[model samples]
Target: MTIAEGCILVACLLPIACAWIAKSKGFGKPRRDGGFDNHSPRQWLASLQGWQARANAAQLNSFETLPIFIAGVLVAEHQQASQPLLDALAMAFVAARAGYIGAYLADWANTRSILWTLGLACCIAMFFIG
Candidate 1:
């Protein structure tokens, strides 16, 4: 797999990391009854408050980007785009996403939006890279 592909795999797990940040780093305590209190994941997430809430929100947003990113990568691959270009764009997307996660957790609204744009641009750019 290309480095881009590897990063894509890593991106899949980012939400898990976000959850960890919220539940452990932010709360410093496990949830009652364990494992998000057996609530529907989204419902449980909606119940979060403070930095944990932000982290949960970011985690949701992280999942939101996946379909577009995956489609872009697959389309680029089908069109025989340059591997190095795909790699670069994919990595940029991942980097932007990481920044977005940080910005969301830190309540950096402007920064998070900027990073979202950057990541979206990377996904869009992939389509034209053929």
Candidate 2:
């Protein structure tokens, strides 16, 4: 796979990382003692608060943004866009997404939004590159 394609894989895994963050504190403990309850995962996740809650929210947003990013990369590749430019944009999108997750986990609302926008712009820019 190309560098851009590798970036797509990285982008796809971001949400999983966020989800892991959301559940990190609850790992390796009993469910009754506030551990990650696999039986009722949604309920357990719903009960999260603070940074964990934000992580969950970030995970959802990551998932929501993934389709567009994937589409942009695929469409750009199909159109024979400049490989280096496409790769750069894809990498930028991944970096922005990582920053967005960090900002979310840190409760930096404005920074998170800015990073989110940057990621989106990267995706949009991909469609125009050739």
Please provide, for model 1 over 37-75, each residue's C-alpha lDDT reduced to its tens digit, 9 standing for 90 to 100: 444656766777888899888888999999999999999
Off by over 4 Å in 1: 25-36, 39-42
| Winning model by lDDT | 2
- Write down the lDDT that model 2 would get: 0.95
Worst 10-residue lDDT window, candidate 2 = 121-130
Q: After superposition, how far is residue 117 of candidate 2 from its true place, in Å?
A: 0.5
TM-score of each: 0.87, 0.98
Question: Clashing residue pairs, candidate 2?
Answer: none
